[model samples]
Target: MDVLDFDLSDREFWAKPMVERRDAFDRLRARDTPAFFAEPVVDFAPQGPGYYALVKHADILEASRNPEVFSSGSGGATNIIDMPGEFAEYFGSMINMDDPRHARLRRIVSRAFTPKMIKQFEADVNTAAAKIVDDLLDAGPGCDFVAQVAARLPLKIICDMMGIAERDYQFVYDRSNVILGGFDPEYTGGDVSQVVPRLLNAGAELQQLVQDLASYRAEHPTNDLTSSLVNANIDGERLTLQELGSFFILLVVAGNETTRNAISYGLRLLTNNPDQRALWLEDIEGRAPGAVEEIVRLGSPVNFMRRKVTRDFEMNGHLYREEEKVVMFYWAANRDRSVFEDPDRFDITRSPNPHVGFGGPGPHFCLGAHLARREITVMFRELLRRVPGIEGGKPDRLYSSFINGIKRLECTF
Candidate 1:
C-alpha cells in the first residue's frame, strides 16, 4: 500500500477537512505496521523520540490491555511529549499515572462514580436535559447548538456534582477549554508560543477553585462528590489537596469536554442521517441504548491517547522498544474495517460496536463512561421528543487533534 503524505503530529493536519483526515487514517489502518511520526515540537517540552500511530483496532486494544508494558505514567499518557513536572501539579490525575497510584485513585473515585451513584444523578440529568431543550426551544433555531445545548448539560451536571455555583460555570468552562484546547488558536489566543502558559494558568485557576471548594467541603460536608472525595470514606481514604485539585481538573476537563462534544456530534450525525433519526424517533426510549452507542462509535470524541512502551514487547506482529511511545488513535480505530462494517455509516442500531471512544477495555477505561452515556441519552431523548425535526448546520470544528469538538454548530428545525 502507498504511504499517506500527512503527518499525524503536524498541528496543521488536524485542521484539514474531515474527508482528508479520514482518508489519511484509512491509509494508516491499511498499513502492515503502525505508522511512526515525529513528536510535534512545542516550546513547553524538548523534542522526544517519535511515536507509532496505532490506528488499527487490534493494536489499540492490545496496547490498552497491557498497561504495564505500555505505561501511562512513564512520561504521561495524555501527551505525546513527556509531561513537565510543573504541568503534573495540575494535569497529573490518575489518567497519567500507572499501577498502585492509579489503582488507589481509581478505587477512591470509583465509589462516587458507581452505577447507584450515577442513578442518583439520573433525575438531575433528566431535569437538566429538559431545561436545556426548553431554553433551546424558547431561543428557537439558529442558535449555536454547542453553546446553547450540547455544552450546557454536561457542564451543569459536572458543576452540580462538584457543588460549584452556577456563577462559576463559565469560569470552569473556559478553563477546561484551555486545558484541552490542543493547538486551537481560538482558545490559545492565536499564539502557539503562549499555549503552555495559557494551559498552566488555566490548570492553576481550576486547581485553586477546586481546592477552595474542597476546603469548605472538608468541614461542611455534603452529599456532593466534592465532599465525598475530600472527606474520608469508611476505609478512611481521602484525596490529598493536590490529588483533589488535579482530579477535579481532570473531571471538569475530560468529563465536560468529551460528553459535550459527543452530544454535539450526535446531533450532527442525526441530522446527516435522517432515516436513522426517523428510526430513533419511532421508539425514543426503546432505541436510546443502541443509538447512543452508535453515536459514540462514530463521534469518537476523545480521539487519541498516548502510551509509552515500558519494555521491549511484541504485540500483533510488531515490536515496541523500551521507552518508545505509541499513540492510540481512537478515532481511526473506531473506523477500522476489521471491526465495524460500513464504518463511516451512521446507523443508530450498529451492534457489536466495540468502539473505544471511551478508551479501550483496560484498567484505564473511562471512570465516568456510565455518566457520560446517561448524559448523552437523556439529552438526546429530550431533544428528539420536543424538537424531533431539529437539525444541525455545518459544524465549526475545533482545530485540535485531541478533541473532535464542534465549537459552534447552527441548529434549525
Candidate 2:
C-alpha cells in the first residue's frame, strides 16, 4: 500500500484552486479510510502529533456526531500544536468542549439569542441588506465586491448585535480580518516571523475590547446581545469572565468571517455558473434558500476542525487509537462523490443538500446558522433585484488553509 502524505494544514496546499484540492482529496479518500499525515507545523508552533485526515463524508459525520470518541475538549480545534493553557481556554468556544461543559456553555449562550432577539435580527438583516445594495448602486460599477458588498451586511449585523459603535466596527473588522487571514500578506504584511505574533496581538486586542464592552454592559444593561450575554444565566449557570471572552472571540471571528466568505463565494460561483445564476434570479423567493445552502456547500469555509481521540475506535477496519489527532476535512466531505450527485456542479436547486459547511452533524453546529442564512438570502435577493447585471471578476483568495476566503473580488455591474 502506498502512503499518501496529506497535510491539511499546509498553506500552499490550500492555496490551490478548489477543483484541484477536491481532486486531491478524492484520490486520498479512495486510497486511505483516514489518510495519515505529519501535520504541518504552522508558524513557529511545534508539531505536536501526526493526524489522520478524515476525507470521507461518512467518517467526518461519524466523528462529528460521536463526540465521545472524537473529543474537542481534549485539545483546541486548530491542527497546530497546543496553545498556552490560558490562551487556549480563552480562545476556545463551546466548539472546543464536550458533554456537560459544552451543554452548559451552549445553554447559557442560547439565552442571548431569544426568539425576540432573532426576530429583531431578521429585521436588522433586511435593513442592512437594503443599505448594502443601495451603497453598491451609488458606487456604480467595478468595485471590489468583497469590500464594497459581500463583507458589509454580516459584519454590520454582528457589530450591531454586540452593541459595538460605528467607529469600532472598522476596528473589529480589521482585527477579525487579521485574526483569520493574518497569514495572508494582504492583511498581515511584513516578515513571516511576525505573522503569528501579530495574530496573537490582534486576538488579545479583540479580547480586551470585548471584555471592556462586557464590563460596561454588565453595569448598564441594554437590549443588545452583548448585554443579554453579560446578564444571561440558565439553570443557575453562567459563563465565567474567561468563558465570555472566548465566546466573544468566537462570535467576532466566526460570525463575521463565515458569512462574508460565503457571500463572496456566492457571487463568484454565480458568476462562473450564469445559468444557475439566472435560475436563481428567475425565482429569487423560491430559490434563495437552496442557493444559500449550495453556496455554503461549495464555499466550505473553516476547512477542517481537529479532534483528539479519547478511546480506541475502528472505522472502515482502520484503527484510531486514544490520544491520536484526527482532522475532519469539512471541505472534502462537502464534495464527497458518495453524498451529493454531481458534487462539483454548483446547482442553485440542490435539494437534500446535507453539506457540512457548518461543522457536519454535531453538537457544536454553528449557532448563528439561521441568521447567517437569512443574511445571505436577503443580501443576494437585493443584489439580483437591484443589480441584475452585476458580474464578478477573478478573486484574490486568502492564503490560509483554515478559511476559504476571498480577500478581494472585483466586480462590475
Best-matching candidate per TM-score: 1
Runs of candidate 2 with Cα error greater than 4 angstroms are 1-6, 114-116
Q: Which runs in model 1 stand beyond 4 Å of their true positions?
A: none
What does candidate 1's lDDT look like per residue over 45-135, in tens digits?
8999899999999999999999989999988888889878998999899999999889989998888788999999999999999999889
On residues 131-187, what C-alpha lDDT tens digit does candidate 2 reach at each position?
888888898788889889888988899889888888898888898888888468776
**What is the Å distance of residue 114 in model 1 from its true position?**
1.2
Give the range where candidate 1 is weakest over 10 consecutive residues by summed lDDT: 229-238
Stretch of 10 with least lDDT, candidate 2: 78-87
Best by lDDT: 1
How close to the true structure is residue 66 of candidate 2, measured as C-alpha lDDT?
87
